[model samples]
Target: MTDSGQFNSELMAFLDASPTPFHAVQSMQQRLQQAGFVRLDESQPWQLQPAGRYFTTRNGSSLIAFVRGTAALPEGGLRLIGAHTDSPCLMIKPHADLYAHGYHQLSVEVYGGALLNPWFDRDLSIAGRIVVSADGQLRSRLIDFKRPMAVIPSLAIHLDREANSDRTINPQNDIKPILLQGGDSSLQAIIAEQFMAADEQLVDYELSLYDCAGATLSGADSQFISSARLDNLLSCFVGLQSLLASDASHTAVLVCNDHEEVGSVSAVGADGPFLQAVLGRICGDQLDSALATSLLLSCDNAHALHPNFPAVHDAAHLPQLNGGPVIKTNVKQRYASNALGAALVKQLAGRCGVPLQSFVARNDMGCGSTIGPISAAKLGVNTLDIGIPQLAMHSARELTGASDPLRLVTLLTAFINSVAPLCVIAD
Candidate 1:
């Protein structure tokens, strides 16, 4: 119900607050709690009622929220939206502190297909979940350095004459980020300083380096948005906004999973049982019937046509920033959208008076995938892959059209709140 400008302002604030997946879900929980949503525990018996809005979390990274719609079960089934919270970044390795030539650095491994060179000469900080010894077992808490704590400086061009054109980065040798220059430096000691702990030891951690400059509107007319983790966090926030504003007739659900950037195979990933378990409990004996009519809107960011490299995308299917949301497709099933699902999306866009676009990677180029295929295969539900087009997908910072996010949220709100069932759509 909010205007686009107001929605975008809040979206940027959400991006700034969620530096890591753990922080992302926490922000989501806080927003949903403020919207009159109650928290549900996986270990407890769920007594969902009509008109109730509730949510649950796992591994402090993934989240699932649902609203019992005004309609009865089997009449409309579940309207689902899915996205991932994690993005490509460098994660600190165990015993990461390393000192050489009076400089202190931390050992890190690339989390996904990240652009290695852009990571250099940029401000970086650490954030993620930490486990400390509590009473007897371990307890977890999220932390953010929230300051420029590290950088991966490029080798001087003077040292290598062809450094500009002939650059080769070794992950093992060159990608280690410099934290500080000093002696007797310890990564654990730095992390311990952030903990409000007494008689507690840092046992386990999953921290990743992030850009601290945060999000802002860019471009000549300030029509572009630049930020870290926009690959899917943009979708997560858009889906959240849509769900909050939706007035659907059927049950509605929103899931923001972790580990999509890393193949979505972990306990909290889409490849696992998280969605299935929740759906099983929600529908109980009606699981089969509910799934037959359910639809999953797998939301993620699409690759926009880069002016410098337009051939990277299919000529006819090129998507543009600010155009609107895209219905992504792949002949390889890498993206799960089909004719039936596409029709449903187009119809909803028409009903909402929003423009729509499509994206297909160049035939010779390998296409990236989303959680769409995984969830469809797991639950036997029809799935549609859609997203707002953006540039610099795996870079520390990415860009998108300033208006596209709110536009997508408007379309999604229609999809989730639609009165008609999407079960047997005509092509």
Candidate 2:
């Protein structure tokens, strides 16, 4: 197989393992550990030496790692790649206990920007981290009640008649997923049995309902991917691969954050101190200098203008599949990139001989933001937001170009390894 073919295979394998945010971070932790990276917890004291590789995790969801450069922490600063792990899905609520209309059901609160309609009538499962009671202490356990377990059956067309033409879903009333028969069991009871924990110890959980079906390669020659949480996981896989591939003279870091889809305010989010804490420990007093010249790349998925919904996107800047990576910008600073950040990425793309695309939302439509703005604000660093154009963003099965992920990795490797500074452009 060719190099691109090889990357495609590797990426699909990575995506298959990461169905939930917890799984995404755990899988990443394992990969980094195998690559000679030592694990460090934030609560413990850190003695990071030059040329060492260290990592830390937050809430078992977000992760940050740093590879010390050949030289001492440079005044020119650190190079960071950031991506989010949590995707839009139905989250099981605290009072998740319910038996609605003769079926055992789990009350779920919608998390992030989910395309709600796609969830209807799909076979679903529950997966995430659970805090279980254990001998007067609580332990966090990762669980995936993996099976064709739950579903939300849509209303029949025969009943509504105009279902296809004009139907609207009320999330509060219509979107709850049916799990099992009445009086069969409680969700907590089932979870305790799955983990072999005491019924009393499985006190609470932060679980999300997910599509139970396997993610597969579709289209002729398997050129397309159909998966449940590709919106951001695709970026996570690309960023981690590029970080591993990078050989930078400056410190190289990759941050996979959780809770971005809902507002990014959690301890594991970009807005929190997770990234800052890692940098402070790595650079210490040099943290200030690092922020002065440091650059962050917020990698996420951008929406490609659908051919059928041409009016919804900016007519002139329609991003397409197989169109290479895109430099996302917003006049309102929704995306943290200015002309300089975007140009810097363009230069890297050119150096790598890779194609590049640009994305701008329709003037009237509200644009989506990434970790770029939050990271920049929190660290006061120079940052750029970039991504691969994708369709069905926030949907159960998001789609992207077959070739774009590797292209992104290539561009990022070039950027991380380059010593050139990002030149600021004046209007």
Best by lDDT: 1
Candidate 1 per-residue lDDT over residues 1-427, each given as its tens digit: 5577777788899999999999999999999999999999999999988788889999889999988887866778789999999999999998799998889999999998898888999899988888898678888899998899999998888897998888888999998888888779688888897774767888989999998888998988989999998988999999998889867467889999999989999899999999999988778898888878878999999988999998677899989999999999998999999988898889999998889899988889898999999999999999999999999989999999998888898899998888878777456
lDDT per residue (tens digit) for residues 266-326 in model 2: 8888888888888888888888876777789999888887989989988778888888888
Off by over 4 Å in 1: 134-137, 425-427
Q: Whole-model Cα lDDT per candidate?
A: 0.90, 0.83
lDDT of 1 at 326: 94
The reply for model 2, stretches above 4 Å from the true place, is 197-200, 424-427
lDDT of 2 at 81: 93
What RMSD does each model have against the real structure?
A: 1.3, 2.0
Assess every candidate by TM-score. Answer: 0.97, 0.95
lDDT of 2 at 214: 70
Q: How far is 120's C-alpha from truth in model 2 (Å)?
A: 0.9
**lDDT, candidate 1, residue 300?**
94
In model 1, which range of ten residues has the least summed lDDT?
A: 418-427
